[model samples]
Each structure stands twice: as structure tokens, then as C-alpha cells.
Target: MTDIDAPEADVKRAGDEGLDARLVVDRGPFRLDVSLTAAPGDVVALLGPNGAGKTTALRALAGLVPLTDGHLRLDGASLERTAPESRPVGVVFQDYLLFPHLSALDNVAFGPRCQGASRAEARERAAAWLDRMGLADHAHAKPRRLSGGQAQRVALARALATRPRLLLLDEPLAALDARTRLEVRAQLRRHLAEFEAVAVLVTHDPLDAMVLADRLVVVEHGRVVQEGAPSDIARHPRTDYIAQLVGLNLYRGQADGHTVRLDAGPSITTTEDLSGPVFVAFPPAAVTLFRDRPTGASARNLWRCEVEGLETHGDQIRAVLTGELPLAADLTTVAAAELDLHPGAAVWATVKATQTHAYPA
Candidate 1:
């Protein structure tokens, strides 16, 4: 059995038609340079912070924004200058962009009708799509009459009605409330799974990307910082932003055998036998704080740090510690109260050598 958390990259099927593109779009001070590839039945997610050029790259792929340089291809055909409507592509915008006056059926049927389908044929196809989306009973309802999830599904149906070979979704679940997002995300995952073409989705939510996509391409400042299975990236983040995003305290250092001398000041011991520059990372939960220095602790990694700040993180207290090595540490609320952890408090922190993971930088 495969690990449920493994990334899609680890198991991508070979020899299937998919997308191949190296997009470079420049506008004033902003420039997006990213390369992406996907296989048939693959769902690739472009994940990054806001203004990280994720949507810009998607728009370039959809032909809404022309590329300044590089190429766009799908299934071995070039589409550098293809018009948005002419390309074998479909897009679901951030806001759904459903036609307010059109019933759900007409909204989904519009795509087919525009492609020269007869009214009856288009309606038949649209009805089937609505049925697949569990919205057959709402075929006659207008956009306002439907809930957020329903409207989103309608948008998806409309996009798929065109039978696109490549689909693009820009922040597909950004508009939904938290609870609605969870429900719709599961639904979207099912729909994407059934899609036979290459699908690319833009999202900043790590959980969304991890749950819905087979592979994740992390972009930052208009360039791809990392690309891999979500599980691999989570276990070994290359950049500070990625480490922080994955909730790990990451540091750069030089390693010799089982120990790493951090560039920041302190050193860390790990189980890996590595040499040369490397990165050492550990979860905040692995950290233990002491109000006073311990007389004898078995852990070789210890540092005296001053509490810079404290905040609540999902029922635990996250203490921001600054010293030779600045890092975040998580403690249960009960433990925090017992230690009276507060800003400006001095404490000793320790982590076992077994807890720290080191990888090549």
C-alpha cells in the first residue's frame, strides 16, 4: 500500500500526453518566470504567497496574458499565440464568474454552445454535467439562488463542458468560508481525479494543494523555489520561507559527520553522517523549554535564549526565542502557564540529536 501522504510526483504515470510550458511574462516592474510540466491525469498546483506570480503564470498558460518569452505547449502542440477561446483550455476564475441571469443549466451549457453545439445538444451535455455535480435539481436556478459551493460546482461544470485538454483554476476555493472550503475541496478533489487532461490549480493554502494536487510547484518572487511531492518538500524545505510555511525551524550550517555548526551561532547534533554545508531543521514541538538551567540533561543540543514574544498556536503557546540561534518553540498551554513563559524571560531550550534532521543545502 502507498503512503497516503506521498506526493504525486513519486508516482506520476509515464508516457502520457500533458502540458509543457516555460512561461515568462513581464509587465512594468513585475516579471513572472516559471516552467511547468504535467502528465495526463495529473493535477499540478502552483502554490506561493500572494503576488508570487502564480496567477500571472496561469493567465499566461490560458492565453489571457501573452508571454514575453518562452513557450506554451499542450500534448506536443505549440500555443504561444493562441487566443484564449480557441485554445483547448478551460479556466475557473477566482470569483466563479457565473452569469447572474443564466440558470445553472444555461451557465454550464454556454461553453458547448459557443463551440457550435446545437441548443438541444448543449442542454443535454449541460444536464449531464449538472447531474454529475449533484446539482441536477438546481438546473433551473440562477446564480443568486445557489450557495457558494453550488456556484463553484456550476463554474467547474461550465469549464468542463468544453471538454478542455488543459484546465486552469485560479484560487478555486479562496472565496468560500472555512467550513464550505473543506466540503468543496473534497468535492473538487473528486472532480479533478476524474478529469483525464492536465489540470493546474493556483492556491496559497498548503493543505489545499497537498490534498488536491499530485505535485506542488512552489514559486516565490516570480521564480520557482522548489518543486516536488508535497511530502518531500514538507520533510526537506530548501528555503526559510518554505520551512516556516511547513512549521519547522530551519537553519543553515556546515556539517561534519553527526554535528552541524550553524552559521547563526549555535551548533546542532544530528544522526546523519554528512560533510559540507547543510541545513538542520526540526519541528517546534520537538523543543523543550526549562525555566532554569538543568544540572544534567542527556540532550547534546542546548541553548540559552530569551523569550522575545509569545502567541497562541492551535491551543499551544508558540514562544519566539532569540539568542545565539533564533527559533520558535511550541509548548502546551498548561506547560507554558506552569513555567510562566512571557516576553523577556530567559530559558534553556534543548532538543535530542535524534530529533534534528539534516540535509544538504
Candidate 2:
């Protein structure tokens, strides 16, 4: 399990710097090839669908999984052949993975003990970490006696107790209940902010990625499809998967000046000036629905669509439409009822050119 392609010749790499890695892992039919970098004090999130190799990439950095190719440099040294336990790395897994038989403090102290600290010294360090995580009172409690949030905090405390230069968290909040997740997520955010180290978190939850990381790297089928500041990625998703995750209607097309002709046989005018292959996107709420096509509508981008389905989403009704262009539209229940929207009902969908954003593909 500790096998590596080749060990770096020198051990001069500093632990306090940052992380720069290009990980490539091949597992029969699957292959993960992604490059990631994070500065000290920066938290980067790896987000994608299931089986997207997010956890594999994290493991490769931790040395639990071997890299088929590529290199991993932390701060300024190479960890291409470092063992998992020897690497200056810590991991908080999705399940928290606290020893059921051990007390919270003992669990947190275990890492320091493994690193050669005296029993008393390890306990002292563990106490400080638990106190920092607001779990000083639960230090004596076993993992079974702790609540979900408490156990999560203990796991984080254990990981941070190791004083790793590069910390890895895989679905850090996935084990908690909805209510506990909210509380733990906030607490975890604070802890991550205080850590002056390179932190990489893997999560499928968009909210978690948005709230926890300074930047997001989106993986798809073992490849990095997008990487950017959270806000930029949210506003301008380059792929359909990203657009769907961000709740937008996206269409690929060819752009000429302010007009783009969709590959689906519809043309949309956008305010952006772009050419060649492009993507035109807009919010579901930007779409206006009408029972019938209106003459001389101010919105020039129009499509005659048939309502494929309808469902209540929060305070709005989300309608799936299929026709000249396939897309989802969000309308208030009142408006939907007024238009008698239902499956098979014909409707006109319109969006203002100003509301649509077009970018090069």
C-alpha cells in the first residue's frame, strides 16, 4: 500500500509552505487526473458528483493511495513517496472515524502519541485542541456518548492536533443531521479560518463548498472541469453539471455579436459580445411564461414550449418545459395557476436579452 513510482531525491521540502500537486491515479476503468494548489491559510474545496474521484485525490495527497503519475509538493518539498503516517498531513473522514472504545480526549491525543510525544504531553495537547473546538467538557466522554456534532468536533480536534501542514477533509459535514450540520458547518468554518495551513475539503454539497472554501475545484469523471473563486463559479458555470448544481438554465450555442444560435435550434440575444462556440445561461426566474404567444412582446428571446411537468419548489412552482429549447422555469404558484400550467399545456417562454449571459465555450 506504500508503493510509489519514485521517491524524491531530496528531503529539503519545508512543511509550513503550501501545497502544489498534480495527481493521477488509475484504477482499471477509472482514472483521476487533476492538478490543485493552495496557499497557506487558503481553504480549497473539491466538489463533484459521486464516483468523481474526489476522495481518491485527497487520499493520494495523504499517501494512502499511490499516484500512477504526477507529483505532490507541499510548501517547497516533494512528498511523492512519503508514507501516510510520515506525511505532514491530517484527514477528517466523512464518518469522523473516532475509536468507539476511546474517550474523546484519548482519541485526540492518539495522533500526538503516534508522533512520539510523551503520554502526558499528548494529553496536554489534546486538551488544548478540545478546548479550542469548544468540547472541553466532553473530553472524558467516549465516542458513543457524544452527539453527532460532538463527535465531528472530536474528529476535527484529532486531525488538527497533529499540527499538519496540509489538512484534508472528506465530506466533513455529511455524517450530521440537518440541524446538526448547520451548527457544525459554522463551527468548522471558524476552525478552518484560524488554521494557517493548506486545507482541501471534498464535498458534494454546493452550500458546504460555497461556505467553507476560498476557491472551488469541480471534478467530473476523474478530471477537473472547473476551478475558480466560489462566486465566479456560481455566476458563470461552464458545464451543464455546474449550471444544474447552481440552479440555472444553460444552453450551448454559436455566438455572433449579441446573438447566439443554440445547438437546439433556438437563437438567443445576449448583452455580451462573443463569437464562435459559446454558452448562454440565465436564472430560472428570468424566464417569463405566457398562456399564449403575444405579439410585439418587448422580450425578443421567445420559445414556444410545452409544459412537461410541474412541481412545487419552496414558494414557487418549477415547470419543466420541452419544445424549441428544453429548460426549467420557475414561476410563482399564483402565476402558474393563472396560466393553468399543466403537462401538455402550451406556453410561451421569454427572457430579456439583458437577463441572459453569454460566454465563450
Candidate 3:
């Protein structure tokens, strides 16, 4: 969808939640300058690698870090100079930071109580939130007694209990084990979907970003490299990091009729037509390797490559190759063994032009 179709109501709520920030922070040699906006009912993921300033951006929004420049507006009101507690924003940290001394119910009630709710009212609201998060049965359990997933849900309930217009979560599921991550991820998705305010989450996991956010903001070296729907970004990644994250080999080329010439020196024949600058992408599994270069092959794209690295991913072996074009090829262990492939082995990589997809770059 176009930017015009983006949720204006959500944008207003994001401001109301008190998270309008044009964060410009400098730490000696490093500088983070970014302009961000969020709306109620909008879940935006701040995604990037370590030291890419994802957390710095979040901290700036939450008032933990001071903005060196730029204005912050919440609900059209200024927040650049507002104190953290005075803002309506709620934050869930990477570690959840649940009070170890408090029961599940009490942990959730802390926010509303601090907000000046009476004991009875806070307890009632906390109970209701616990029930919503499926933690009502564990209301009396302390953080130490609860599972990772349960603690995460409690932390989320606590954040929501404050009735803030903007919600912030940092690595919400990073503390869970693989098994628990799957369970909590689905549960988190439901909660995010039901949240009516603007929500921003910071995560390095692509699955978390794709599953939780309506839009993804990819940050690298303190700049947004890409932003779009999960599927759209997955299909058309603009950077090597994004391409690797989305598990596709992306190439830019020019297409004439059925033939596409890659800038990397491989010509592919496809069924698409009418293209100027185009992008071709395929998964590593789509590439086939040959012990010897096959002659008169019907496949349109062929290249000679030297294996740069090899690693096993589950039952499959992933071969990293460098040559006329950098490519990754997936092969079975049996095939790898048959070819005696090593880091310096020579191989022929081929792809049918039909398997190459061309889209406007």
C-alpha cells in the first residue's frame, strides 16, 4: 500500500502515546539520526543487526536517551522536552524486567497503581489483563515460578495495563527457548493484532518482525535501508543483508524478450517480457551443482564457481561459492559426499532461465 493509505489514526495515536521523535543521538564517534512515526493500531518493527542503532532509536523514543536534535510530538503535542514518567508511553524491555518480588497479578498492577489507581481498581484491571493474556491461573505466581513464555505474557499485560496510546517492546521473545518461542510468537501475534494503539517493537529475528509488525523498518548503520510489508520486502530485498535474511539470491539485470542478462555476467532466459532494469531472484535450493560442466545444457544460466565455504543446515549442506557471480547452492549430504566437495572445489552451477524470476528493480 502507498504511504497515503497508511493509518493516519495510528499516527495520531502514536503521538498521543507520546513517541514522536526525530531521534538524533551521537556517542563520541557514532551518530544515529533517524526520523520515525507510528500510529495507534500500527505495529512497526525496528529491525537491524547489532550496533545498527535499533536499540538506540528505541531508547530515544522512551526518553532513556536524549535527542541531540529534532522535535518529538505526541498527539500533536510536543514531547521533546517531556519527562519519561510524564509521557503516556509504555515499554517492555528485552529482558521483561518483571519485579521478582511481586506476584503475576501484582506485577501487572504496578503500572496502574503508580498511575494513581486505587488498590481495588488496579487489582481488578490487572486481573482482567491477566485473564486476557491467559495468565489468570498464575496470578499468584512470582517471576521465578513462571515459565519464560508466561513471564513474557505477564510483562506484556503489565505494559498494556497502563492504557498507554503507544507501546514499545524490545526483543519481546528473545529470552525464550526455541520451543517456547514458537508458542509465545503466536500468542504475541494475537495480542499485537488486538492492540488498538501504536506499537513499536525492536527485534533481530525476521520471523518476529514479519509476524508481529504491519510494516518493517530495516536499519543499518543508523539509517533505514528498507521499509515495506513483510512479503513485499521478502520478495524484493534491496541489500545483501536483507536478501540473506529473506533467503534469496537477488541479482539485477536487463531483460529483452525472453532473455535477461545479469550484471554479474550470467544470461538467463525466462518467460517474462517487457523489462528495463529488472531483478532476478531464486532460492539457493533452486541451484543445481555439477561435478563436471555439462555441454549443450538447456538451462540458460550457467557459471563456474569455486566453493568458498560449506556448512550443514539440518539435513542439507549449503555450499557458498564465488566466481563470476557469488552464489549459494544447497545440496544433499549424499551429493556433497559424492562430489567430495570442499572449500576450494571447482563446480558448475546452473539454473533454468524459467526458474529465474524477473521484476522491476
Candidate 4:
């Protein structure tokens, strides 16, 4: 469907010299409102859990979904009333949506044909793209005969062949096997870097977002929770979802000097001293577990906790603790065996103040 019907006089403009959009879509009980802006050559990743409205935002930009409010613009021209096929947008969907009936060259040629290129011109352009993608020899292969990586590259070529002003990638790497994913991810990163247009990517994998995107926009429950450079967000997460994604234990609290009293009635000691509401965060490895209280522990923050569960985390074991405070501790197999960790096992958890980071909430 096209965007919400509006008069030409009422149409809004954005994306001056690149892309800028404030997408809002309302569907029954769900509403998606997201603001996006990017310059040419920028690669932005949209990250979220299921039903977080990430796909809806992407569709709105593509004109696949109608916008209830807000505007869409590319190169400073209005697209709020543009049809999906008419918009200067290209999409590489999660499934790579290639036509099984078409050969690889024909598939990539389809876009230019639709845009009014002659048969010979389209084929020549498609051949150049296929060659650039390292698929020149596979031009005659059908979609079914192509490997997952090959299909993905063909899909990307088809999208890029259109010479769209804005490109959208939905879970570009989710369809590949681990090995193929590794290879394609590197190739995709190189292609994206060379793309001079604005590109928006959607994925649930933290590594993909970190590796493929220049900036990250995190969505949750139809709203943006946080957004910034991948490294900045990884080191200083503002929400629990971001904290978990970056492998850290985070808590909200009110800070008084070095002590931050958690909203849940516990206190965390941090290295930074500041007043008012703040966030305290640290890595799971910062926690140490002991079967009995040691006479002289170096850690000043101690809590009586019970092991709620245990799980393998890479080369270490992650223990979930509850009772005096909720915490996660990472310990080696030998340490876990010495503590005899299990559900309901009581232990004392200690965290050195130096390991905790404090920042304004």
C-alpha cells in the first residue's frame, strides 16, 4: 500500500542530500514511531527483539507499509505519496526473495528493465554487477541452483542494480550457515563500504550490527531505547536489553558519592562518584562467590545470595544468584566445582568497587 493519502500541499520533505525520515505506523494495538537520518555512504543498523517494529519502520521507508504520520524523503524530495515501485528504494529481504524461474543474470536485470532499460542494456548492466559480485560464471544458474551465499549476493546485486537512493537490508546474514555467514558478512561489509547511498540494515545479532553498521539504532516495544556508535553503546548501555546484549550486569539506582543505592533496596559501590539518579554496571566476572564469608576479602560489596541456576558461557560458567540481590557471576569450571554451585546453594557474592562503573541514568 502507498502512504496515507494527503494533499500535495501537505506533503513533507526530508533526507536532504541523503535520507531523513520520521516513520510512524499504527496497526491495531501496535504503533511504530522511529526517527532516522543518514548521509550518503552511511550504514545504519536497526536492532530489536521480535515484534519491536523494526521491520515496520523499514517497510514504511520502502513504501511497502503506509505511514500513519511523519514524512519520508530521499535526496531532499518528498516520498510520502510515492508508490512502492515508484520510490527510489531497494530492499534485500531476510529470505533474499529471488525468483526461481529467472536465471541469475535475468534476476539482476529485472530492476533496470522495470525502470525502462532496453533488453541489451539491462543484460549488460546485470553482467557488470554479476562480475563485480564474483558471480560471472554463475549468470546462467537459477535461484534454486545457487548456494545460500550466492543467492544472497545475487539479491544484493539486484537491489544495487536498481541504483536506488536508499537501500534496506532485512536480516541480511540470518539465512546463511555459520561458515557461509562468516564469508558473506565480510563480503557484505566491503560492498556496503563502497556503496555511496544511504543503507539501513535490520538484524538481531549483536555481532552483525557491530561488524556491519556505522551506527546502531536500538528499538524496543515500538520506540527507540538508545542509539550511538557500536563501541559507545557496547561500553555504556542505557537499557537492560542493551546491557545484556553487550554482556554486562546493569542496575538503576540513586547515587550518593561512591555508593549507589539500587531501586531494589541493594547498594552498589562504583568507581565514579556523582549525585542523583544513576546507573551502575559491571561485567559478570567482577563477582566472586564463596561458600563461606572470608575473614579478609578484598571486595567491599558483599551480599548473601543463593544460586538460582547455572549455565555454560563460552569457556566459563555463569551462575545466576538471587536473594539479597540479583547478580550473575562468571567462574571457571574448577572454581564452580570448588563452590559446588547448583540451584538453591547459598553463597556469599563479593564485587570489588573498582570494577563497577557508574554513570547518569
Candidate 5:
């Protein structure tokens, strides 16, 4: 069976779990097309750069964007042509978009009320959802009265109160401050873990996607470039974008035993035993820079490089170097000032063989 079938089989055994979609959406000037599937209780993240159509795919599944072709199946039923309100789908937009004038309880009750529940029944269900989301105290508060994190939770409760079979979140944590994001992300992860339905979230933050989703579908130019578990994708990135996203320096090479001959003009000695086309990856922090090429160092990879640029990130300075091999080196401000490092400075970069990891391409 294909990778797609493997997950579907797991979902069938899990009972009312998962969604399968083959979506094709065409705008006047752009077309987005992709196939995706996730098992019940699975949180799949759609990750990509700006204009990569991550949002478009989410919108298509939510019935907000019409599909030019393809199918959407939840559990076992076809929902390709279903209307947004008619489908068993729940959506939490980037801004949360809660009704500022309504109490949190009423906002959560909106969906069930629209679904034909009695006012009393809807309010009861909404109260239960608010309690579950840890917002019981805030139920009577207006959206404007809640903090960013609290507002996010209310939006989540509103979506869950509808009892959707599939939940869609568009940049769920994008609007929060850094501190709020951390707290909300942890809360969201807990909720997603407890959710029995299939949940798909669209995000540009790698950390958010990695921590929140069981698997990731990476898109570029409106097509899927890679899709797999977060750990797998992080270890074996297939494209430069994925490499950069995960903060690794990747190079294609030909390997024999412990030595890999890189196409970019260097030979790296690694501990991995691999053959044929391979990839070598290391972090910028693993690289050590010297004012002059060393003779007695045990490092297997060493190259003379000219500093191209230097920039500060947090407490560390990242030095961009170009030579036989282009590399990024992270150094302390004290070390940088001591070395008098600046753009156009010539330096030697060295890395131990054990610091480099090689895998089949």
C-alpha cells in the first residue's frame, strides 16, 4: 500500500477518525492543487512560505474557496461539493474574529444555535465547552475584555462547541505576542491531543508546526514539496527551503565509507556509513572560526573563507562566509570583537567529523 493508504488503514480502526482530501482550487491568476490525508486524532500542519498557497488549501477544505476539481472525504462520506455551513467542519481564523459585542458564552453558542439547537441547549453546550477550555470564568466576558491568550481559547471553544468532525485553524498563534504565543501554543497542543476529530492547521512558524502537528505537509509554489513526520522532515530535508527552515546547512555529496565528497568543493569526513547520493548537514553553531588555518587541529573539515556578512541574532553574531564552501558561523560578541571580525575579513572555518551527519539523499 502507498503511504496514503497506510494512514487511512489506521484511521479506519480508530473509529470516526480522520479526513481525506484531494483539493484543486483555481483563482483567476493562480491555481492550488494537492492531495492530503490524516488519521483520526491526527494534527497535520500545512507549512510553507508566503504565497505558497497554504491558506488556499485550508480555505478549499473549509468550503470557503471553491474547488475546481478533486474530492473531500470525512470518515467515509464525500463532502467535495458541500456548502461551508452544511459541512461538518469548524474553522478558527488567524484573528480569532470573535464577536466583540457578544459574551464569550454567546460566541461559543453561535454555532450550535445555527445548527438548530434550542437557545437553552446551545447555551448549555457552550458552557460545557468553555469549562473544558478553562474559560468558565470568562464565559460572561466580552471578547474585548479577554487577553490575547484568553480570546484564543474562547475561539477554540466556539469551534469545538459546534462538534465538527474536522477542525481547521489558520495561523492560530500568529496574532499573539511572543509570551502569549508560548502559553497559547502549549494550551492548543493539549486541546488538539484530546480532540478525537481530524485537525489541520496552517502555519509559517516551524516551531509551531513541529510541536503541534503529528505530520507536516510542506508546500511551495502551490504544490506539495515534502510531507512527513516533523522529526523525519527535520532530519532529512529534501529542499533548501526546508533546510533553512530547520536551521541546517545542507550539501549534496557522494559518499564512500566515512568520507563524503561534496559537490560544493569540499570533502567531509563523517561517522555515517552511506553510499551513492547523500546529504551532509550541520548547524551553524558547530562551525569554529580561526584567524589562520590550523595545522594540528583534529577536525576533518577545514576551509579558508572570506567573511561576507555579519549580523546579530539574540546574544550571538552570525557570520556568513564564502569560500570553497559557503558557511554560517555563530560566535559570541566578545569573541567577534577580540578577533576584530568584519565583512571582507579572511578566516578559516573548522568542524569536527562527528559534528556532521550524512544520510542518503
Candidate 6:
């Protein structure tokens, strides 16, 4: 289930005919270096922060950006130097990039037409694809007349009609409204799951990645920071970027008995008994903040912190604090007023030992 770099012979012997590439692209001060390998029927999602080279990696795979080094292989063939149009790759851009002048039907048929299909055959194939996307009624409608979701499906049908061996999507749902995104996302998931070839999507939304991808490849600063099943990554994040993405306060420390002495400065008591290096994680909701230290509190894990900032997170107010420990705590709107939580308010933070989960790093 892993797609990290493996020996070439081992991969070939397993009958893996999918995407095998080590892309290295340099642009001025930024350089993208990412290695990817996935077999057929695999939907891999690339997740990262802005300027993390997620788009650059996708462009390199599509041949839009030439690689400075490394190889690009798909189904036992090397496409390292192949032109974008010559490669067996299909790209669904962030904006859907549909043709303004052509109707939905003609736009879809354009891919097959470029691949040398006859006009009649292309239209026949396009019609069937639109029907499959549940957009048969809108086949003759121009891009201006169709909705955002309709345009996205048309773009997908067009990309899939060419029979691509490797499909790449750059921010597939970023352009849609919230409600439309949810609907289109479910449709896209079904299509990608049905796709028999390798499909890779780049997205910033954690929900989109978790719901759509069979596996996630988390990139940070032009490198693969973590790659695994979405559940596995969510349970045990290896970096701060991922911890924030999955909504957890993560800290690495040395563990002995039930105590974890954080490398950053403080110690956290947890229910798990472990030894050596370990990661201690707890949710923001587990933290309780007060104006002063409580004398009869049941929580053994306590820290003195100052409120650095505050923001509304969902239905609660999430306050950022820094002092004895830097962490985020979620409190009710009324409780925040009671504590007088402001930019410089001093507060005592406490968490029950059972709320913390410790695992070997």
C-alpha cells in the first residue's frame, strides 16, 4: 500500500504498471523534488501548504515543466523528455479550463479529436461520456449556460475520453462553491474509484483528500514529509504542518512511565506507559483555561500560558497561547469572557492525563 521509492526490479516483478516517477524541477529560488509510484486503481492525493510545490510536482508529471533531473515512467515506459501533448497523460486544471466557444459535447469530443479519432466517432464517444456524467441533457449547452458543477463534469469526461494511463488533477474542486463542491466531490470520488489507471490529485482541503484519496502524500517544502492511508496519517502525524491540518496539538518528547518530558520545555502526563522517544497528542477541546491556577483541579498536566490571539473556530472560540507551553485551547464564548481572554491575558491551562494519547514516534 506504500508508494515511496522502491527497487525497480521489485516493482517490476510485482506486475506494477502504473506511475513511477522521481521529479526534480528548479525555478529560480524554489525547487521541487518529489518521488511517486502508484499502481493501477490507486487514487493518490498530494496535500501541502501554499508554495510547497504541489502544483510544480503535478506540472512536472504532465511535462508542462521539464524536469531538472529524475525520471517519469508510466506503464513500463519512460516519458522523461516527452512533450505534454505526446504523453499518455490527462490533466484537469483547477479552473476546469473548458472551451468557451464549444458546446459541452464538442468540448468533450476535442480530446478524442486530438488523438486522431474521426469526427463521428469522437461525438459518439463524447455523447456516451456526457450520459455517464448525468449531463446528457446539457450536451449541446455552451460553457456560459452550464453551472459550475456541470462544467467540471464535462472537463472530466473530456480528460477520460482520451484513455489516459496517468491522470493528474490540480485543485479539482477549488473553483466550486461550498454546496456545489460537496456534490461534485462525491461524483468525482466515484469516477476516480472506477478509473482503472493511476490517478493523482492535488488539493489543500483535508476533507477533500480524506474523502477522495485512497492514499495521501503530504508534501512540505518540495519533499514527501509523510505518505500513508488517510486514517494512519490522521492518527499519527509526523510534522507540525500535518498536526495542524488534522486538528491536533502534537509534541515530541522522551517518555518514561506515564510522563513525557517535552523537548520544547515542559512535561506532559498521559495514561500510556512508554519509554524512549514518543509523540503526545491531544485535541484543543481537551484543554481547559482559567484566570488562575485551580487548587482542586483533577487535571495533572498544567501549564502557565498567555493568550497570544483568538479566533472563532466552528462554534467555539479557539485561543492561541504561549508561555510555559505553546498550544491552542478551545473554550465557550461565555467562558472566554469570564477569563477575560485577550491578546495579553495570562491564563492557566490544564488537561486530564486520559485526554492525552502517547505513541512511539
Q: What tens-digit string does per-residue lDDT give for candidate 6 at 170-227?
A: 9999999999999999999888877777999999999999999999999999999999
Q: What do the candidate models score in CA lDDT, each in turn?
A: 0.91, 0.90, 0.85, 0.90, 0.89, 0.91
lDDT of 4: 0.90
RMSD of 1: 4.6
TM-score of each: 0.94, 0.94, 0.90, 0.94, 0.93, 0.94
Q: How many backbone clashes does candidate 3 have?
A: 9
| Backbone clash count, each prediction separately | 0, 2, 9, 1, 1, 0
Candidate 2 on 6-114: residue-level lDDT in tens? Answer: 1111222355568899999999999999999888888999999999999999999999899999999998889998888999898999999999999999999999999
How much does candidate 2 score in TM-score? 0.94
Q: State the RMSD for candidate 3.
A: 4.6
Model 3, residue 65: distance off in Å is 0.8
lDDT tens digits by residue: candidate 5, 180-202: 99999999998888777789999
Candidate 4 per-residue lDDT, tens place, 116-188, comes to 9999988988888898889999999999999999999999999988888799999999999999999999999
Candidate 4 runs further than 4 Å off? 1-16
What digit string (tens of lDDT, one per residue) describes model 1 on residues 1-361? 3311121113334555699999999989998999999988889999999889999999999998999999998988899978888998989999999999999999999998999999998999888889888999999999999999999999999998888888999999999999999999999998898777899999998989999999999999999999999999999998888888899999999999998998878789999999999989999999999999977898889999999999999989999999867989999999999999999999999998899999999
